[model samples]
Target: MQDPTATARPRKIIHIDMDAFYASVEQRDDPALRGRPVVVAWRGERSVVCAASYEARRFGVRSAMPAVRAERLCPQAVFVPPDFVRYKAVSRQVREIFLRHTELVEPLSLDEAYLDVTAPRSDLPTATAIAEAIRAQIRGETALTASAGVAPNKFLAKIASDWRKPDGLFVLRPHRVEAFLTPLPVERIPGVGKVMLSKLHAVGIRSVGELRQWPREELERLFGSFGGSLYRRARGIDERPVEPDQPVQSISSEDTFARDLPLHALDEAIARLAGKTWQATRRTERIGRTVVLKLKTAQFRTLTRSLTPDRPPASEEELRAIALALRDRVDLPADTLYRLVGVGVSGFRDREEAMTQPPLFE
Candidate 1:
């Protein structure tokens, strides 16, 4: 084996994505479900698609779509309630397989993770080999298949992972980054959601090559803070390392209404989101002092208001009250209709720092 540190070599990152994770699990456990369209969800107006087999996807049924719509799309689809306990167990077994290759495992969700195996404990000759080995191990141990992408950075690896999915492997060599990324649509870049996509389109920048033509300062002026990220990603430049444990920034919840509602109609929605945020925050030792309210108007503009209280909220009611009062911060017309509302807790401080702070009255 040659020395890894003896010369300059780009970081080797791999993104592993389990194919139709929950659906695959269901099919694995039930022999009858194999090669059949399956939709895992409850039967109700509020029930959403938890997962759909590739067979169901052919009928335009997908995860997160309404269960009613999923049924209409594929009437013959087998519906099953989700079994998260089994899914998590399988996820744990897959994670154990990752720990054998490298400690730099960053789990994005139960179904996906990023591994930095630039230096592998297994002394693998290259990242591609490690990806293959892990995929083989997962299929043998878990009775499932995963797609693997090997690249020099996380962004490229994530894209490459999806290039040939459902038991596929793709590699983006360091020398081929520019050639591979330049011709792709701007939407292929991370953070280019619908709103950002519209913004890019309005600017007459449809491809990454066109997006990269703009000066950084101009891009920043046009898109605010996200513009910097846009500029770098256009050229396949991502400096972020695959951190094992990403820090928690906030806990929040929001709901999109079936019909746009006036601001006065949001009281119940605010309370629901606040209660969820408060419950989620309880899982963290870090204390949050700021209460944030997020709203989106029917005109498609997003507005945010936040208040850092003298003390963190002590109960769900207090959090709800703070979130509800934030509606007054909206300076729009009284008749302004809103489509979404959210409540959150942020500005985190560890218990040690929170305990030592002087009282607000002081």
Candidate 2:
């Protein structure tokens, strides 16, 4: 049989990411913050850095690092509180730019998005030109710099977008994908975190070239379902499309406290976040079966417990109860303290499908 994948036309995708988004926006609005180490975060013992300017990054500051640690790392860094309203306004402007080219824009966050320019509405001659136009438009409109990656697929495009630091652009042509990925570290591929990296290293697979050396079946035997994905990703194969309105799988809200709280003391926090998440879920037409409780220990380790009831939560009280009950599932010691807590629901199904049959209690 002929190669099935080769029959499909290669997609023209672009990944656009703002540079140090929150920090960069602060720097742009305030002349005093420009060219300085800016750290956007809430200052507290438990708070984590949300964004770090390139200057702060040089001092080893990064997002998700504790604010106290970030301060210690970059003592001179200016800390700024996030202004989501302003960020949303700027994000809207960025989206408008994308819509000018193509409606196939999938926003990953307020600061980054994937765009399918395979069939753009603009007069641009090529995908690279479209990327340049988008980047230039963002700089002009938002007064901030953006990096762009033009590639044949989303995975390569995302990696390419980060190839250059603040205010850079890179392209991954179909003809050059193999050579470009061969010598690069396997960690460069998404989902290869520390544990995965260690596992790959133990097998003497350190680079994309080394990963590609393994037979797909053997890799699957080693890492389960993920191994199959790795086999394909190593060869620069990704079939995911840039969906404009990707289905919302879950809605969640989380809070990081000023101090770590023991498991028993988390009831109030869980209740509060459950309310927030419940309100968010009301906007969707889907009902979720799984209620998840997420906790981050003082040591930065994360643990999640989920329960899928026979029926979806029908009320805020029910959502809160499910979230609270999930705490019972955490096998950690009673003394374990968590610095953060979140409540969410997933395993979504359409309202029609979810309500096709009456509840057991009803």
TM-score, each model?
A: 0.84, 0.94
Clashes of each: 0, 0
Residue 68, candidate 2: C-alpha displacement in angstroms: 1.2
For lDDT, the strongest prediction is 2
Report how far off residue 354 is in candidate 2 (Å): 1.9
Off by over 4 Å in 1: 1-9, 253-273, 294-304, 327-342, 354-362
Compute the lDDT of residue 217 as modeled in candidate 2.
98
Tens-place lDDT per residue, model 1, 83-177, is 99999999999999999999999999999999999888898898999999999999999999999999888988999999998899999987778
Worst 10 residues of 1 by lDDT: 1-10
Q: What TM-score does candidate 2 reach?
A: 0.94
Name the top TM-score candidate. 2
Q: Which portions of model 2 miss their true places by more than 4 Å?
A: 1-5, 357-362
Go through the candidates in order and give each one's C-alpha lDDT.
0.89, 0.90
Cα deviation of 8, candidate 1, in Å: 5.2
